[model samples]
Target: MAEVHGCNIPEDRYYWIEKHVWAKPEGDVVLVGLTDVAQSLAGKIIVVNLKSAGKTLARGKSGGTLESGKWVGSIPTPVAGEVIEVNGAVKANPGLVNEDPYGEGWLLKVKPSNWDEDAKALVTGETGVASYREKLEQDGIHCQK
Candidate 1:
């Protein structure tokens, strides 16, 4: 497991270092979601509005908005492409973000037009874990651990 600022970063994820998002390869398309660190920083999510299907989104662009209590923020898409799917489960159960973020709590499914190009921008495995730690230290966020 990866940890940053005392936040959990499961090593299984493919992280978008810049956008603060992550993706899991699920067949031809990918299952996208916010990393645990992101959710913890964003607080308790209340509502989410995802880019509809067939909607075109730019790489690293905000594909949807995340509302957490009084905080409102965007979840940038890691890949440049159209939104093939959105998680209705999250829409109905916004708390799922706090429940099982890496699993059913995922946000979008992007059909990356340039996986080879964009995937390189994201960090994974040990490298990703290290990066998240560095980012937290830079931000003066100490791990809860």
Candidate 2:
């Protein structure tokens, strides 16, 4: 799980450690979101700047933006892909990020151009949490969210 501040990380998703985003795969389709830890740290989200559906994104590039009280940052993608849908729920109620960061708060759905090549770099399962813990310690951040 993503142990940033003690939030529960969904076991099935893949994570981008640096960006703190999660990617849930469904065949060629992928769902994206800020990890539980990321959302908790961000505090309240006032607004989200989402890329349009059908927009093509490159691997490791920012797919959209999250404007929270804590910091304004880009949400990165693991795979180069075409976005199929942007979360309407989050658009209307930005606070959903805080309420359910891993589920209904999901930001987008994508059709990755290359799943295998891109997914290779992501962290999963227990190793993912270990990796996140190292990063948190390196940043001198304490987590109990």
TM-score of each: 0.91, 0.89
Q: Model 1, residue 107: what's the lDDT?
A: 93
- lDDT, candidate 2, residue 37? 73
lDDT of each: 0.81, 0.82
- The worst-scoring run of ten residues by lDDT in candidate 1 lies at 136-145
Residue lDDT tens for model 1, 1-145: 7556667888878898656689877778877898776777677889988999999888778889989976798888888887899999899989888777788789999887877787888888889889888887777765322
Worst 10 residues of 2 by lDDT: 1-10
Model 1 alpha-carbon miss at residue 99, Å: 1.7
